[model samples]
Target: MALPSFFVTAGRRWLKLALALGGAAIAQTIPAHAAQPAAPATIRLDYLHTGNATVEQYAVERVVIEPLPWPGNMARTVDDTDRGVNLVEVVDKASGKLLYSRGFSTVFNEWRTTPEAEKTNRGFEESVRFPKPEHAVTVRILKRDENNAFTLAWSTELDPDAPDVLRKQEPSALRPIPIRVSGPSPDKVDLLILGDGYTAGEMKKFEATARRMADQLFAVSPFRERAKDFNVWALAAPTPASGVSRPSTGVHHASRLGTRYDIFGSERYVLATDNRALRELAQNAPYEFIEILVNNDTYGGGGIFGQFSTAAANSDWAKYLFIHEFGHHFAGLADEYYTSPAVYQPSGTRIEPWEPNATALRDPANLKWKKFVAPGTALPTAWPKAEFEAYSRDIQQQRVALRKQQRPESEMSALFKRELAHEEELFSRAPERRTVGAFEGANYEAKGYYRPQMQCLMFDRSEQFCTVCQDAISTIIDLYSRPAQR
Candidate 1:
């Protein structure tokens, strides 16, 4: 009636592997006298999101069983936050019972807004991951319509135990290094910080940079207050070169992740077009969220909700870039600043965005974050808009001239510091600068859109998020991990 010696050894090996995934803190949490919940295999559905401005389509490419077990909290399988432009739902195919769901945004959604998408079709490789199911299920991809209603965009039947499913993969030497271990992954928010453009010799440097940023991230509100509810991991496969490509500056490198600047014709935008490469290296880590750090010194980064975010690790504003982009990726918060350059062509109509922060303000009486707004504050809150616009216009001109003349990155950094200082001084004098009043000139528009606060980390190069943003972020934290005791 006793287990065989070989079987006992194999069970011990699996225990070690699971412990390694969580590091010392997690391993210690497993009591010697208690039973542990069985971890399920991670299931990933890879597909293509192809479309233009007017239409979109999805097609399944493959199904994969990742090497690591599911790290998400099985207790919180349903997402009720109601964020993101798209949602994925897994349901029992036989009984029509919802099994799991999560809201997410895709690169295809961002590209559809670009001018190039108006004239040509583009495709982005995308993937949706979830805990493997017990039986055959129907996977549904839902998209929001103009009125903010979700409709079934695509659906397919899937069998987790299918013979053709990709269950085996060649082992890679890469393993995630524990940057900060707080608890077991299922009970904590597991964040993976990936490094691109880092050489094998710079491995230590990557760890240092990732650790520094992770510390900084926890220093901010919401994250700061709930730091113990999260764990941080760092991973990178050495690249042949030391920096990612900056095509706008005519400097190109063979970065392993295909991350580069000049995305969508925006000089400062950075993104990784190679989703497969990004996901492959990422699966080696136990993570529910990812923030990639590029070793380049350029002022560029990008984030897509449910996909990932990238940040320039060596920029003067690297810390700010790390959190701001992560805001987009983590909470689906929208940018509030209107003066920055962008690649998307304006649609000129203000429709309510699904993002929690920005608003169309068509119904001012029912502002999305009205609960935070003080009574009697103007709906289209008045501020020194004219002066701010004038200053921003001048800064934009100087910014263009600097890039055109090939000015040093230091010069640009200094320019940004000066600009932020000017705005801080200007807004500091306002009586309601910190109040949660709807402010015009958000969503990259000079009009028709509003923001919950006059300035925020999403609005400017500020250090902390506004009260409304903080609340929004806190909501997501509650969804991922248990609420911090008051």
Candidate 2:
């Protein structure tokens, strides 16, 4: 074994030859990220958005440099698809030039519509993230005025290199599992499917559900067609139990993300109010969008535009909730259903809604989706509203009673199946079922507001999005799937 001097010399000569080649062979010595230019660090401005129905205010909490680089598409720095109630603009402090802007609705905005906000003062911790600039920058948050114009709500200046900015953080042992990776984080839509109530023993079940839901998401049109434009990742921090809190039925468990059912006294509403806890865990993954997976079979989910969405991963209609709630979070689309009870009290005035799918129809001739209208189609489209409302109203009554009685989840699922079957049968016979005409009743209103179609996933448990909703979602898709402009 000690007499192999000739062979050792031959191996050294071969390595020298590879090094002299001066191409991929030489580049192999360096890491891939090192070979490419480093991405800008992700900067998050955490703040308190607090106040009531008549007044609102914002104050800074702290700024943090997230662990991962910005997962957003750098080629398209500006968001052109205007949506949401608020807009965030980042400008160069000294030059006063706009650097980045995005439209997003906060959880506080939704909460403000509820009666609770009218009676009490509450604060919500919200965050706006942007690519870290080299120097100081001004962050401005704008809210819509009564005239529907975006006016400055709050402004603050901060330096990325400031001493107070949090740079170092506790290392996360959590790692993301790739469900479907089409390309690099910046080039594709990076969606993080986070689990909130999975125990260490159920990690594998969480993973399987995540993958299954992700696949079903792609099975829908648009997403199915544009499947290659996305990268899906799943990550879950172990919890002490397997299901999230459901206070209505006296079922409670300690959850890592603070996600729970019965949000705002609505038994079927699920939400996580703790933004910091959610962000801390999500920061470990390269995600531009997050869909929290709650380990429960309850018929509940909630979505806030630009904020994260939650769905009961174990529900019988899990796929429906997964796609529908994501539609709200990803595209800022509003609910098109109205027969169901909502926690939010309606504002006295019926101003035009900002959502792309729903409209006030103040000027029907100039409808937002007028282009899709057939030549002879009515502006205020007529449908079997009376009969449909009669059926839906009865279903709503049954729904409330079932929850009041603390009925089994299987009964709820069966009721949903019946409701869907009735809706399908009812709509299938209508002439304007799939038409692009405006249908009265949407945005939690039986009057004034109108949706683009008679039935859509946004409106009901239908399988497809309405034409207008499809276009609206596609616009957002293009925003994320920015063409290589750089």
Question: Model 1: runs farther than 4 Å from truth?
Answer: 1-18, 29-34, 483-486
Per-candidate TM-score against the hidden true structure: 0.95, 0.92
Q: Which ten residues in a row have the lowest lDDT in candidate 2?
A: 1-10
Model 1 lDDT tens row, 1-486? 232121121123334555776567567766666444455678999999998999998899899998877777666778998899999999888878787899999888888998889899988999999878778899999999888888999999999889989999999899898888776666678899999999999999999999999999999998999898887999999999899998878899998888999998888888888988988999998888999999988788988888899999999999999999999999999999989887778776668988888899888898889999888998888888999999999999999999999999999999999999999999999888978888998888888888888889999999999988899988888777745322
* Candidate 1 structure, TM-score to reference: 0.95
Give each model's whole-structure lDDT: 0.86, 0.84
Clashing pairs in 1: none
RMSD to the true structure for each prediction, in A, is: 4.0, 9.0
- How far in Å is the alpha carbon of 349 misplaced in model 2? 1.4
Q: What lDDT does model 2 reach?
A: 0.84
Candidate 2: the clashing residue pairs are none
What is the lDDT, from 0 to 100, of the residue 400 in candidate 1?
A: 96
